[model samples]
Target chain A: MTRFGRMWVMTGLLLGLAMPAGPARAQEHAPAAAAQAGGHEIDIQHHIGDSHEIEIPFVGIYELPRFAPIHVGGLVIDLSPTKHLVFMLLSALIVALVFVLSARSIAGAQARGRPATGFAGAMEATTLWIRQEVILPTIGPHGDKFVPYLLTLFFFILAMNLFGLVPGGATATGNITVTAALAIIAFLVIEVTGMRTLGPKGYLGTIFYRPHGLPGGPGGAVLKVVLLAVLTPIELIGKLAKPFALAVRLFANMTSGHVLVLALIGLTFLFQSYTVGLGASVLATGVLLLELFVAFLQAYVFTLLTSVFIGLMREAH
Target chain B: MVHALMLALQEEHTSGPLTVEGGLMLWTVFIFILLLLVLKRFAWPAILGAVEAREQALEQQLAEAERSRTEAAALLAEHKRLVADAKGQAHGIIVDARQLAEKERAAAMEKTKQEQQEFLARARREIDVERDRAIADLRREAVDLSLAAASKLIGERVGTDTDRKLVMDYLATLDGGR
Candidate 1:
């Protein structure tokens, strides 16, 4: 994974800086001139939104192949890969390459009685710290088995988030569609792991009884059953709400940062001056850095919350 | 047609950022699962195994070092005890030898002192006997000379027992009177 991660990162960064006057150049005149900007509002929308073409305003805009009209037994399904989808593929490839490569280094270093140095060592430290400190502590010792799943989520989201900060790359997490899919996976894991660990009855017991068991005597059992039935809908809502929050939190955080940066850039044309453009770039720089921080922070929060949910389900109560 | 165009433009402007296309979500799921499978199969096991193996090796090395140190300490204590024991034994033997030497010297001195006393007594007895013999010889010679002088004065050869007796008796009486 490290190999692909390095390749993608280098490519992304180089394409970003070297392409000067590229996407950033797309905000020309008043941004209201080309795609119908609403005093910078429309421009901000277009900038963050997914597009069917790779647009580098100064050089070219290449329209992607459209497959929305494909017919399969009279049922048409659109399966074309958009800009975000391409980056999404790159993100996956990056994740696969980084982990696979680093795993090889770690395995090899074991023979020499040490760890891999430089980049590989840093990667190893992160993996270990997250597994031991974040996942295992929350999920318990048995949580060791789930380390790969949790780690993959972290690095994948992290890669995509950071990639979005690069000049031309679309932040996949900024799209609600992408964030919703990730949240669905988390929800499945939480519910499925709960079922598997607690065994169907024990799983329902979480929504009903307090982990120990149901009440003892007849009157008490009746009272408890009444409480469980009364609160079951609320418990069900709580279960669904956790993943929803996870998805929205990330989607909002990433989308807001990009919107802010685009707005700062759009301010240049709003005032119609080169000096304003320079000043706006300076201000945008600060927000750009904040977006970078948010990228890492949001990824961490998503992974941590997912782990916490899994832990709550796995452990006794 | 112009109103339709106007509506299309309005929709285009609003449709981009917030739209959650079903197709993109499906694509994302497919991509994420592909990543998960690839990582799980190709990467995770090796990395986790290497980490555990390294930990075990480090722990084993530390334990071996501790054992060796303990054994070395025990051997050092044993060596020190042996050296102390040998020194004490040697000192005891030296003291015993010195005491034996002192006793032998004192016995030899006592024997030599008794032999010297006996020799002195014997020498004193022999010296007294020699002195007595010398005095007797001198007296006899004096008696003989006195007898010869009397005979010459009388111009006669006298050999009688009575005459000899008288001479002896006269000498004895003269000595008693003096």
Candidate 2:
């Protein structure tokens, strides 16, 4: 922020601090304080963290019904519904519904010999762009086969990310586990396709490939084998690191935006002045909107990297 | 899920944002799998098929349109060629007709000129014949008169055949010389 903006914020916060309310502040700030003793850090975590109950700001908290009531030696499976799970499921259903409706209309258009319209047209444009520009360019020659998977990944992640910005929603992608699972799926697809294309021996050789031409001798053969041994782990790590970075990049981006938004809101509570809170909220709105853009950008990045990884794995050179 | 960690967990160890609980992970994976299965089975095939079909249709339509254009151009060129051929034939026919008429006209004029020369020669022949006949008659009369006059002058009549023949012969010689 500029100096003028900062002064304005501080003035608002000072005015907010002049207000008086004891019990509500103490009660609200209690859970927040458990994370960070004093400061805006506590509320930020409370906002993004997964919880047993769905907390709606205007509406009261609604506790999820628990499943698997039996406890196995005081260590339950903990396989009950969560706020994250609800929102995640909701996001999935929404994505499915949108695509299903669009697909049906498109299919109908094809049947009747008419042009695609409205949402179907939009979906068509996006699908075609991904096929031609994103997937085809990256995977090369017959890269079109990967379109379904990439489309699923792109739209799925995009929907989930946008869902997080809802009034009473949690970011499913913000969770490490979610990002990790997605990355794991992408990794499996990459490896399987690589193995399918290159064959087992070629795939293994690619992992340990040495560019230098080996001299014709027993000693040179031994040296080449040794060099391969030395370089194999590095190559393997490099392969694994692509997916790892993909997961972290998405998780960090999604989580950071929520954190920023929360912290800004928490600034109002920190000052205990409604005027300062208002000013902070006004400021946070900009970032909140930016989060929407970041959500899309991060989803594109994840899908793009996955494409690049798949491309890298499929091509021997 | 109602994990005891939320309300009564330690702030220090649990403070890290990267920590993963088993429950959330399981749910996420399960939900994702369910989503993939549902989409792959129901949604993807339909959408991808439609888009592919539409694209192919468009390509086929475009190709057909191009073929039609080429056929039209060829037909136009053929029509133009036939028109040009007909025009050339008509021009040739006109030239032949004019040449034939010119030949007939020249033949008729030559025949008329020959007939005029023949008629003039015939008239000259008839005139020459008539003039010769008149001269013969005049010579006869002159011979008879000359004989009569001579007899009168001599106060004698020459009744001998030889005398008449001699005078006639002398007249014939004068006529031939003239």
On DockQ, the leading prediction is: 1
Q: What is the DockQ of candidate 2?
A: 0.25
Residues A7-56 of candidate 1: C-alpha lDDT, one tens digit per residue? 42443344346433122532432233433533333245555678887654
TM-score of each: 0.73, 0.79
* DockQ for the candidates, in order: 0.29, 0.25
The models' CA-based lDDT, in order, is 0.74, 0.73
Local accuracy of candidate 2 as per-residue lDDT tens digits, B26-95? 7777877787777777777877788778779899999999999999999999999999999999999999
Residue-level lDDT of model 1, residues B94-165, one tens digit each, is 999999888888878877887777787778777777766765565566566766777778877653677777
TM-score of chain A of each: 0.82, 0.82
Share of native interface contacts present in candidate 1? 0.65
* lDDT, model 2: 0.73
